[model samples]
Target: MEEFNINSVQVILWKTMENLIEDDFKKFKNHLKVMKDVPLSKLEKADRDDTVELIVQTYTEEFAGKTVVNILKQMNLNQMANDLQEKVLKIELQPMLEKQKAFEDARRAYEQREEQIKTQAKYAEKQINKGYKKFDQALQDEVAAKIAALREEEEQKSQMMKEKIEKMNREISALSDTMRAIEEKMRSDDVTPPQF
Candidate 1:
């Protein structure tokens, strides 16, 4: 037997117990009415006895004092408790979600800073390498220029020394020729060589 029937379901009935039970005979009559309305077509013939028994029990308990009312009150309180638990879970999760978001933001910020630092370091390294290359090139050019200048000065000095040597040889040759001429003249005249 079905403990509750969907066919006879009433949205308003759950709102008030008085609608289901008023006095003793009225309760009994309501139970019979609901029992007849219960679809026998859906029920197996074997379940008939059980269905009858359940209807009778429900009617008796509902019309009697205290117990059914207490049960209804307990169900309402249980509903309230479930609602409170859901609210608390939502409240607790809100802060946890916020904290998770904060942690994610902080992690992202740290990663960005790390990337920035890496970029700066790379740039600095590149600049240093550039400076070193430039310095190395400058030093090489300066040494090469000095070597070239020294070679040029050495060639100039060699040329000047050659010129000085040629001039001195010419002067010595002229002086030798003049002495020969004077000696010939003195011999032709047959004059005694004057003691100077």
Candidate 2:
């Protein structure tokens, strides 16, 4: 898969064309003319280079190579036919192969991203459920503490009520800070809070 150098392959095809004598070339054309795909008028007027180019245009190098090999073999030029076969890997197939590889790589990356999204969604949902439970418990505790504090305030000194009020103010501030932190974490995770 290094340098394709189509010119090199063309040179090889041209070389085969160069080996053809007048009768051999005529025989070559006769065979090609029979193939419905090969343009009959073009083959008649085509010299060696044009014939090679036309063959390449009509079919791939692989098919052209096969045809050349078969013609040469029929002409009793086995060595030349074998040599052409050796060079006939067909450069046209390489691009299709490369495209296939690129498509596979893209598909794999897409699947990985999809899997990561699923994992993050699961984690975010878990965090939302945890947050809901924590808030429910915190709500119950806050009400219970407030009721307890009210009872104590009625039974206890005025100075003690002032202290409890300050402590309650601090608890409220702490709750606000906790809510902000949770919101920031959800934003970072890019999660929608789960519905009840």
Q: What is the C-alpha lDDT of each candidate?
A: 0.53, 0.80
Which prediction has the highest TM-score against the true structure?
A: 2
Can you list the residue pairs that collide in candidate 2? none
Q: What is the C-alpha RMSD of each candidate to the true structure, in Å?
A: 15.3, 26.3
Q: Candidate 2: list runs displaced more than 4 Å.
A: 1-12, 19-45, 56-65, 78-89, 146-196
Q: What's the CA error at residue 108 for candidate 2, in Å?
A: 2.0
Worst 10 residues of 2 by lDDT: 1-10
Q: Against the true structure, whose lDDT is highest?
A: 2
Cα lDDT tens digits for candidate 1, 1-196: 2232321222112223333234532443344444453344433331323433343344432222122233333445445334334443444355578789999999999999999999999999999999999999999999999999999999999899889988888887888677767777888988666554
Model 1 accuracy (lDDT, Cα): 0.53
- How many clashing residue pairs, candidate 2? 0
Candidate 1 Cα misplacement greater than 4 A, ranges: 1-83, 160-196
Shift in Å, residue 20, candidate 1: 20
